[model samples]
Structure formats: C-alpha cells, structure tokens
Target: MNVNHSNNKITETACKITDEICLPDSDLPRIVIIGGGFAGLALVEKLKHQEVQVVLLDKNNFHQFQPLLYQVATSALEPDSIVFPFRKQINGYKNVFFRLAEVEEIQADSNTIMTNKGSVSYDYLVLATGTTTNFFGMDSVAKNSLGMKDIRDSLNIRHMMLQNLEQAAITCDDDERDALTNFVIVGGGPAGVEMAGALAEFCKYILPKDYPEYPSSIMNIYLIEAIDDLLSTMSDKASSKTLKYLEDLNVKVLLNEAVSNYDGNEVTTKSGKTILAKNLIWTAGVKGQFPKGIDKKHVVKDNRIKTGSFLMVEGSKNIFAIGDIAAVISKKTPKGHPQVAQTAIQQGKWLGNSLLKIIKNESPKPFEYKDKGSLATVGKRKAVADLGKMKFAGYFAWLLWSIVHLMSISGFRNKLMVGFNWAVSYFTYEKSNRLIIRNFKPTSSQTKESGQYES
Candidate 1:
C-alpha cells in the first residue's frame, strides 16, 4: 500500500522515505484492528471473506483463552492448550493479515497508527486493545505481586509457585518456610475465586504427592476481598455458596478487608492486619488499554473510550472501539455495558455484520448486549451458575461451566488437550507436568528483601 505523508512536517533538504509497514496493495477498504482478544478475533471471523481487507495487529501472535488461566497457573493444564496462534486462526482467510507489533500512538487526523515496527493507515480503525491489570496506584504491592492478565503472567505465577515450593522444602527456618508456602489472592471476583480454588486443590491433591516433606496443611491459601461477599456480581446464593465451598476446601476467606501494602515477605491490610506471605496474586481490578491519540474528552470511567449505540467512537467518522476498551454510554446503560467476554464477542460480531452496510451508507440496527449469564468454579465438581432467572450450584453447575468453556476454546487441538487433562484429573487427580524450564525472577524490590524466595 502507498504511504500517506501529506500531513508530515518535512523539510525540503531532508531525505524522504516511506515509513509505512508493507502490506498487500488492495483497492478494498482496509480495516485495522489493534487486538486479538475475543472481540477482535470475533470481528475477524465475521469479516474473513468479505469485501474489506482486515489487518490485525497485536503485541502477541496468539489469542489466549483467559478464563482458564488459573488452571495453567495451578498446573492443571499446560499453557499451549489455552493459547492459539493468530496465523493458524486466519490460515484460510485470504483477506486477513496478521502482524506482530505494539502500537505506540494513533494519528486519527491522518487515519494513521504508529507502531513499534512502522506506520499503517486504515480506512476504518477498530480499537479492541482490551485491558491491563489495575493496581490502584499501590507501588509497593504492584512491585511485589503478580497479576494474571496474560499468558506470560500465568507462566510467571506457575514458575514462581513451583520455585517457592522448592525453596520451602529446602529451608529449615519455620518463618521463612511459612512465608514461602503461603499464598494470598486479592479480590473476590471470578479470577480471584477461581485462582484460590485451584491453588487449594493443588495443596490438597498435588502437594501430598510431590512434596512429601511438608504436610499439605503447611501450604496456606488465603482469599481476601474488599467487599463483604465473594462473587459479588452474582446472586446472594452464589456468593454464599462460593464462600462455603472455598471454606470447605480449607481456603481462608477474608471479607471486608483490603491489602494496603506488601514488601515481598509480608502483606498488610487496610484494617491494621498483617499476614506473612511471599506469593501474592492480584486480580482485583483492570483498566482499558489503548494506543494514544483518542481525544481525552471522550475517555470515560475505567479508562474506556466512549462509543455510540452503533459502536462508533465519539467524535470520529470512521474510528470504532470494541471489547473492554469501548464504553457505550446511554441512558439505559449509564455505566456502560459489562466488560465481559460475552459483551466483547457480541460487540465484535455486531460491528462486523454491520460495517459493510455502514460503508454503503445503510443504517443497521444499534448494538445491543445479551447477557448469557455467569459461571464460576470453586473446585472440582463444585461451581455456581446464574443463567437468567435460574440459579444453581454443585455438580450440575460445574458440568455446565466445563462444557461451555471447553466448547468456547479457539482450536480443536486445545479443546482435546484440555478435555483429556480434565478427564485424567477427574479420575486420578493427576495434573500436568510441573517442570521449571527457566528461572523466574521477580522485580528488584521483591528480590532485595528475600533473595532465597522471590515470587
């Protein structure tokens, strides 16, 4: 494609060269997407063989199944089983192209985006950049703790956990051993609840077999929530049942408590309580992440870009936003739609189905979100579900959760691997191979206090 440099401030004597990223020359309107999350991929799938050319740019080449990251961290499933490559996803889509690049800024005035690699112009830009972990400006806690937001974060947690358990076995000091084996997960959301449950299962099933030196009780799992209940987004029955399930599994559930600080070895809560722990996982909050250049006036709560009912970004003619980054503000949804996979998928598909019509100056129906319901698993055979008016928990709920997630995975191979792993775990309680292939080093702040165990 030809580079557009008409807006650049160029000097006559300076050498002129095209800084545009090479792409196939096409007369069709080019649609550039900035993420490969559930929303972006859904849009790509919808527009694969359409008249428009779709260019997907992301920092990573793989689209990760986010809901099962806890399993990977707890060694129940391997990482590869949850992440699928973009190239493989778009293999037969002739109109689709994938590029590995981290976008730096967006030049909306010129319809150009600047990435680490080079620049690219789009006829229509879709911002699906999703979100990043939110620490709420806690520098100490942010430096010491790990957040499970991506595949690398999950792997880091896995390695940190395995390495800490090994260190706990090697250490003779009771305090240090306690610090090394202790795990504190902040937030009562789905991610935090699932992670705590998985860790508890690991302590129950895997610890006894792998680390015989220490009793399974030696490893403590604590789940802390700032609010009064777990799974606050669900119903009262679900929240209470989830609390009971975790407690039954010996997970310490601390309600109405918030972490104030962490110095690698100790965690201090806002209520003047302290717990000695080396491992802390933060799943409390997240904020939208996108390349710069959108008008600051249009940015709304949770760092999201304001969009109209048609999913078009405010104050832009051809720019749109989807996924968690886009907030469709209206009288009916004053706080915007729920930032979930269902919402993202629905938005992406809606935009994809309507884009061509929109380009032809034909109006399509406005975007509407349909809630598919919520499901959260506490442990094996224990889960909670809220599907519309019906609320349920126990084995049936867990089964439903499993079926939904298994079918939702991107690839057949991943589904098979995950299904096989789940079946083995169901029968014999055997998990994936826990191997420390590479050394995991925490931030400098975490390493300075305790070099022996850093997670």
Candidate 2:
C-alpha cells in the first residue's frame, strides 16, 4: 500500500505511481516496518498510540505463534489455534495499516522499498524481517527435507507425515513402509527435540488406536545433532536431563553427527551412517532473510544485518533493524543476542521507545536485554527449564512451559482453543483434530498446490 508523507518532499512522478495504494498524507513521520514477526509485532504495539503513521508489511497476513507450530504439525492442535490475523490484531489502532506483499529489495539510497505490489518510499524504515531455515548450502537437503519456520511449513509437514502414514498402512513393500514410517529430525535444539518427542508420543498413543493395523514398533523417531548434547544453549544439567527424557520415551538420540545429504528416500550422515526415511525435518539452523541493497560490508555471517547499540543499521541513519535479522553487538553479547522471540521482542520495544525519543528531540537509550530463562517441552508431562541459577525438569517445568506459551499466544480465542485442545488430549490420550482437511500429494508438498479441498 502507498503511504503519503506530507511532511517530506516527494517528486510528483513518484506520487502518481503510488496513488493506487495511497496512504493518507500525514504530518507525523512515517515508519515502514518490514515483517510481522515477534519483533515487528512488539514494535507495532509500542507505536500503536504514537503520532507516527505505521505500515506493517508481511507476505502472510497473519502472525503465527511459532513455538507451537510443531503441535499443529503433529495434529495436537489446528492451524487457526496458533495464527492471529494482522487486521484483527491492529483493529483499534487508527495509525497502523496492514499490507499483504512480498518485499523484493530495500532501495536504501532512495529511502524506498521495492515490493511485489509496487514502490513505497518511507521516512523511517525498520527491518524486523526474521530468519529462514539454513540448510548450510546443502541443496539436496533443502529440496528434499522439510523445515518448520511458519504455519505453512508446519502444515506441509503435517500433510507429508499423514500422507506417508496412509501409504505405509496400505503398502506391501517392506522398504517403502520402512521409509514412510522412519522419522529423522536434524538438529537437537528445542524445535528438533520437541518434534521428536511429539512424534514419539504419536507413535505411542495415537498409532495403536487409529492405525491399529500397523504396529507401533514399525514407527521410529531419531534426533540427530552435530553437537554432543541436546539443547546446547541451556545448562549441562538441563541438557543431560532432556536427553534422558527423550531416551526414556524411546527416541534414538544421535550426537556429534552431521547430516551429509538426503536423497528423498534416505539420509546419509557425515560418519557414513544411513537411515531410509521419506520424512526428514531440517531444523538445524536459520539465517536472516532480507533483500539485496544492504551493503555486504555491513552484512555478517548468517546474512544478519549489523546494527549499533541503539538498533540502528550501522551505515544508515534512518534505517533501523531488530529481531533475528539485526545483529546488535555488545560487550555482553559478542555474537549478538540469541535468535529467539525474547531478543526480538526486547529489541523491538527498545527501538520503538528510542524512535519516539528521537522524534521528540531527546537522547535515546541503548538497548538492554533481560534474560527470562528458557523452557522446552519433551513429551507428556516432561520438560526442562533453565532459569538462571535454578534449573528444573519433569512436571513443574512442563507446567511452566504450558502456562508461559499459553499466555504468550496472541488472542483470547486462540488461547482458549489451544487450552481446550490440550486438555482434551491430556485426559483422553487421543487427538480429536486428526482429520486431514486437505488432500495432500507427496510430489507437490504444498498446501496451496497439493489439491487441497474440503475432505
């Protein structure tokens, strides 16, 4: 959508082209934010009542609760329970506008952004664009394996998994069935661990009841990690306990191993180990996603844009960045903050206030991050939490994990839906929303193109 800035001078030529998506000419400064992730969401909330005209742009119109995406993938929760629409999110905010478009590149020199829709110049640009799954230059893995970064990715996984299971249920070929039933998760981080645990739970609880023809033993879950232990970011105690919990649930943990390739049917490891599996999930790592035009000199490893202590892009004055895309280097965080929701939220809020101060001609404060601890759920009633000096596991950690994630979810409707889904599954040991609403084809592997329709 076009944004009209009356305060700034613009050529008549530019105005004519952008009139179709025209935004009201406003005296207040215009702030164009690139993403709708945690950082962008936090920034929008902070600037909701501010004088500036805010334009929030994202390819998807909804903000997804990423942490629980695995639950959606595993059929423990539906997609609607985790997604909040952008328009509904900013309904009461008069200054905010939502646009559905894919950003092509940042024309920093012209103080404008080129999107799929058209060009829109900005007074201030905030790059809260998050990261994309890093396949580490493995083209074969990228093409063949699945990565969970959003709702679409999660739905893809869900479809692939169910389709494979259906094929296994009817297949006469042993190898084909084995390949369909075997699950390989690359990376022992929270995403990988939680996925492995949830899949294992599906095997133990759901398989016997639903797919009674297939023995639960036929299904195998494997968690492979390049590191020596799981949850490497957390304490050693927490990591060890998490490993134990997964093992107790019968998940095979492969440590200090790197995946070399995936050929659609089999995964080859660096150590020459091979596991035949049609479903390979790659949550190994992620790199910041941004368009060309940011100087390569300012771009660091993992494609992250380097930002100063104030969250401003190093070389540009008005262009600022936050969240996973911005590498804000400090004495405490030499490598920049961890790419988590907390880092994004904190940076966004700090930058929001800082921008307000700058707008008012006051000195802005430097960004500071507050560590609120880390939590990851394993299987049913099993979780690990590292809260500074205190570490906990088992029931209490699981409880805390549930509460925090539930409260962090966007809308009250979503919270209630997710809570109700969890309660039903918790007591019944049966997931109610197992219906495949869409017909998924393995070859296409996309919800939009997989011949999806009402089942």
Candidate 3:
C-alpha cells in the first residue's frame, strides 16, 4: 500500500484519555501496558494480584477479540459479541487501573511513558500494541484498502461492501455496476480465507434471498494472494480441502499473485490482470506498531520489538513486550511466537507470574508459549481444525469451532447472544442483523474517519 499524508480532520478520535492518577506513592512495582488488544489485556488479567500496581493503556476502553472481528465486519456476529469492556474486566481488582490513552513515546532513561492525555512513570512497561496492516508500500492499496486490525476497520469494510451493493443496484453504467459487484480481498491467512469464504456464502445464498432485484451471480469475489496457498500454517490436506471448497462455491482463488496496485476503481495484479472492483479489503501483512524510544535493532524484521526469553526489551529490563509486539527469542522459537490471541493470553499469564516473582524478590523466569492448535471456519457448516496430531474438517469441525468460540467470549450474555445467532443462522441460512444502520459513503462527510470510535 502507498503511504501518504493522513487528513488531520479525524485523527484525534481514539479516546479522550484522563490523567494517570491511580498509582500509589509507595515503591510497589508498577506495570504499564501499551495496548488493550489480546496480549496486553492478557497481561493485565494475569497481573491482578498483591504487591504490584498495574496501569494499562490502550487507544480504546474495550479489549477487542480481533480473531472474530472479521465476523463483525461481515455481519456474522454483532459488535458486543467480540468486544469486552476493559474497565469492566478489572473493575473489582483494586490493584489494576486502566487509561484510554495511546502511548506516544517511551522515555526510557526516566522510566516514563508519554501519552496524548499525560505521562506516567513505570517500574515495568509492556509494549503489546500489536500490528497494523502492511500495504507493502503500494500507494494505491495503502490509501484505498481496508485493513482488519480492529473493530473500526471491520465496520468500515461492512459499510463499504453494503454501499457497493446498493450502488450497483441503481447505477446505469455497466462498468460501474460491475466494479461495484466485484470484490477483491488480498491475503490468504485465516482472516482473508474466512472473509472470502463468508462473502461467497453471502453472494451464493443470502444476497439472492435479500436482494431479489439483481441477478445473484452479479457478485464477483476474488481472493488474491502473493502466496500459493491459504492457511499456510495449517496442513496441506486441510489447505487443499479449503481450496476445493472455495472453488465449489465459484470463488476465484488466485494463488501466487501480488496485488500490484489498486485505485478505488480497479486492482491490477502482478500477472498484469486488471480486476475492476470498488471493495478491496487488505489483510496482506502487518508490521510491529511500537512507540518511539526503542532501538532499531531491538525492532525485528516486521518492526516487532525484539525481547529476551523473559519478554523484556534487550536494553531495558523493567520494560517488557509480549504477543504480537514482543519478538521473543527462545530455543523453539528463535524469533518469537505468532501474533495470535492464544499467544497473547499465555504471555499475559507469564508476565503476571513474572511480576509475582519480582514482588517476592526472586528472578523472573523465562516465558514459554503453549500451542493449543488452530482452526478456521469457512462459510456455513464448512471448517477445519488442527490439534497437533489430529486434523478434522467439514461440518463437525465447524460445530466444534462454534462451541469453542462461544465459550471463549468474555461475558455470559455475549455468549448466549452469539450462540443464539449461530444456531439461528445455521438453521435458517439467514443473518437477522444485516440492517445497514448507517449508509456508508466513501469519502463523504458521512463516512466516519479512521480514528473515530464510540466515546
């Protein structure tokens, strides 16, 4: 994606952070986390105990379950299902405090962190800010593509997709309608694969039922990728099965093709094939998103912060990082663990226990990541799961995935609602909440800015 200047109009809407007034004046060790994503939230949950003061900083007041965020974008799940209030999670823990502030910089020498609202001193700092979409320096893709890192991105994509469909309905021009109906998704990871698969289902069944106006075959969804296979992390059999499933659904799975460029109108691939489409969702790659003051060497290949086995930054012992942000060097993972939610949760626990040891005046132990396998759901009753030696696919795998995801939600109410939605969708082949509450107009004043979030 290409880089350009961001409009100053809507950049300051992350959250109006309050002052950092929660820490005690005594010498209790303080832990400051930079993000509220999977890794940082996990750290806070693990560190809720005696002998330490914890201050968690995030751009948003809620911790977003990013794994299911694509569902929110695609409207398979609602917002509340995948999002949990950060303050509510630790409301009863007297030792924990949260501030809705993005860490701007790290004053390592003074052990202080600078934020939009204010600054605070910390005995330990954890940078779990996670990653942002990597446009790979493609100017058009950078400016016009939608990345799926947070809820905002997903909602924006949903609006854009719906808006395109609506626009395709009335537009007199065939080229315009074709472009509106054509959707290009670049990337073949779980996010990309799942999104493409879901969009296909929408095109195949839901759209036909809902919009009886246009021909159901008007939708042309293309899953473009620079890699040869989707779900590179999964086994070859599983990947092969998914590829066949996608083809069976009439999805164009273009492998080993780079999205050379995308202007809001058309996307050109490295193979020189020009695809006309208005909806381009970019999930290609992500780079480490860290604040200033960390050395360049400490930053890994993807801009991730390089940390020791203990997740402590090389130059600073007290300041640490984990999950997507932490580039851990260990015997098994010489670089670091994948930036997944499970890794973040496990790291959060490790950091919590490490703090416990520090309070007891004992040396912190090295962190180890526990692998819990991986899974991906492709449309209705189609899924795959890999648990170490065992691999499963099809409807049964999809059922297992649904159950596991439902139980992993933060609140019981959310779990119930999500479970209900899943059952209803499974039984009826319909999404009840497809109502486009707000019309998405690209570049119009109605289009919410990238930084905008509910206050």
Candidate 4:
C-alpha cells in the first residue's frame, strides 16, 4: 500500500496487491455504504468523525433533490438548483470518503464488492441504492415514454417538451400539431400530479408569451392514473382537491385508466382508448435497485431486500439495507414502510444512530415508522395535504408544501437558487428559459425531415 500525505494528513493511498480502491489505510472498522441517497447520507452524517471509516459509493457524484424533479422537468427550476455535489456535502468530515463508481456485484462471502472502477472490502456493508422507474415490463411505453427518476430524466423531458413545442410551431398540419403538443402523464402519484400541474401552468402562462402564433388551448395536458383517484396514497380530501385543481387548469384528468401501449406517436390505454401524444412522462411505479449477489429468497416485493427489525438483511450478518430499497416487512408493516422520502430519511437516521451500538454488541430498538403526512401541489396557490387528522388544501397547503421542500434541499446555495426562482415564478408566472440545448431524439424513426415529431 502506497500512501500519500499532505500537512500530516493522509490524502490518498493505493493498494496494489489486493486490487482495492485507493483509500487511506485506517485501523478503524470500515463501513462501506452503497448509494448516497437520503438513508446513506443520513448514516454518513451520524457516523462522521466517529470511531469508524465510511466509504460512500455512488454512480453519480451528486445527491439529487428528487421531490422537486418535476419542477425541473417543467422548467420551473434548473437542474443545478436541485443537485448538490457529494464532495461538497462531506468536505469537513475526515472519516467519510466518497468514490464515484457503480457497484456491479456484491461478494458478501468475502466481504467484498465489485465495481466498475475496482473492488473494495468492507467490514460492514450498507445497501441504500434506492429505486428506479418501474415500467411493468411494458417495452413500448418504456422505450417511448420518459420516467422521472433522476435529474437526467428531468432534463430529457425538458428537452423533449421544448423540442416538440418548437416542432409543433413548424408543422402546418393541425393533427400533427395536436400530437406534438399533447402531453400525457401516466401515474397519479405525487410525481405525476406535480408534473401535470407544472405542465398545466406552463401551458397557461408560458405558452401564450412564447408561442404567440398558437392558441393557449393548443397544448393539451392529460394526467392518466390507473386508479380512480389522484394522490390515492393521500387523503380523500387531498385527492378530490387535486382533481378539482387540475380540472380548473383545463388539464384532462383520466381516472381508472392505465397506459397499455405507447409507440413514438400514439398512447393506447387499457380501455382501448387512444391518445395521440408525442410527449409521454411515465411516473407509474418504482422498484428497488441494487447490485446482485444477495440471496434470492431475501429479495421480496418490488425487488426490495427483506430486512429484519434492525435494518439488517435477513440472511446475512454485517449486511444491512435502508432507504427505498429496503422492505422491512413485519406484522405492523406487512408491505414494508411507505416508499417515501420521510421513511428513507427516518430509517437512515435511525440506523445511523443505532449502527455503532450494534457493532459494539449492544442492542438497539427495532425501526418504527411515524406517519409524517403527505403533501402534493397542483398549479400555483393550489395544493393538498394530509397531516394526520388535519387534512387541508388550497393556498395554505401549497405554502406549507413550499416551505417543507425548500428547507429539505441539500445545500444552502441550492435552496437559495430554487427559492429565488420560485419567488420570481410565483409573482410573474414566468419560468426559467426553456432552451433546447441538445437534440433529443426520442426514436430513430421520428426524424427531423418528417417534421412530425423530433425533440
């Protein structure tokens, strides 16, 4: 092992024989955490400067604020405003180190993990890789439609939308224009509803100013949900209010409808209804994502790893799971805790507070989830909330939603940027400049020559 030092502090190290990732050799027990999501980051925060060495591995170097990804998709916020670099997050934490690598396989027997870059050994392994968009094995819809799982997806949707709108202007055919402007969002969860609302706002405000030739009604927004209610996970009041809010914005809300098929041009529903839409945003579902090597039986519903009370993977010692990727199935939570940010954050914090004790052969209480309520915003000054017995909607709920999300962002600068953008949009109804910087080719068939659709 070759170690480099700066100012009497270990800066880097190379382990040539073991083929291990370069890291300062330490005598302390190393806890390698895969994924820098809410759970992993929370655990990192708790373990920092403590008696353990923490190695954080992630495919991306930045931690994204997922709750506001819809805003980015609809051009209400820029990508940079919602993504914080992982290095910036752990700058002062001496015990914590971040490496940019995608974990490919987990060799739990040897306490080793293989990655694209190199292999690393861990005294304890924590899986917090989180979830990815679930297309339900629909290959057509999966290929044609975009999912809002990350910042890149948000930007892709943005580029697709802007490019389609520009193409809509160029086409003389009315039917082609409708297809180009028609936006279909599948799934009525928080993500889908928020995206629909934001798109509706864009159609209401930005369309008229930007595209003076087309009528405001030219761009049609449709929100499709398999279930009968929007925000089905939320309260009934929230659901109804969301419906009313969306309808008021001229957004066509289709309940009990599921998108069965979608080529590059047409959206076919399960009920045999067809919607001609060039832009399709899928927010239907998500399943846990992690590298292979865990026992098949230990993996449960939604591809989540089955974890015991202490957030430890059932079949393994020294291997734990958290965040959306963990399904802590128990008598109380037969289906595991709700796959939401709060659950992930709480679980992360709990494990962080408890992991040290567990390592010391001390007992820690089982994870217990507290229902913190839900909030979904629909357009400006309109939102819904289910805060334990206090269900509310309209302006106040939206205000609360804004405050909560703003405070929850990772960095101070990001919060300021998002806040400033929101303040400007709130008053002026103006969004960030919709620039189609990249040519978004949704499909190879839809060419720039056809002028039918190319974003």
Q: How accurate is candidate 3 locally (lDDT)?
A: 0.79
Q: How do the residues 141-232 of candidate 1 rate in per-residue lDDT, one tens digit apiece? A: 88999988887788889999999999999999999999999999999999999999999999999999999998999999999999999998
Candidate 1 achieves a global lDDT of: 0.89
Residue 274 lDDT in candidate 2: 98
Query: Scored by CA lDDT, what does every candidate get?
Result: 0.89, 0.85, 0.79, 0.87
- As a TM-score, model 4 comes out at 0.95
- Residue 160's lDDT in candidate 1: 97
Prediction RMSDs, each to the true structure: 6.0, 4.5, 8.1, 4.6
Better TM-score candidate (2, 3): 2
Q: Write the per-residue lDDT of candidate 3 for residues 344-414, one digit (tens) a residue.
A: 88888888888778768899877877889988988888989898999989998888888888877877778
TM-score of each: 0.94, 0.93, 0.91, 0.95
lDDT for each residue of candidate 4 in 312-425, tens digit (9 for 90 to 100): 998888999998889998999899999888998888889887888877989999899999899999988999999999999999999999999999999999989999999999
Candidate 1 vs candidate 4: the TM-score winner is 4
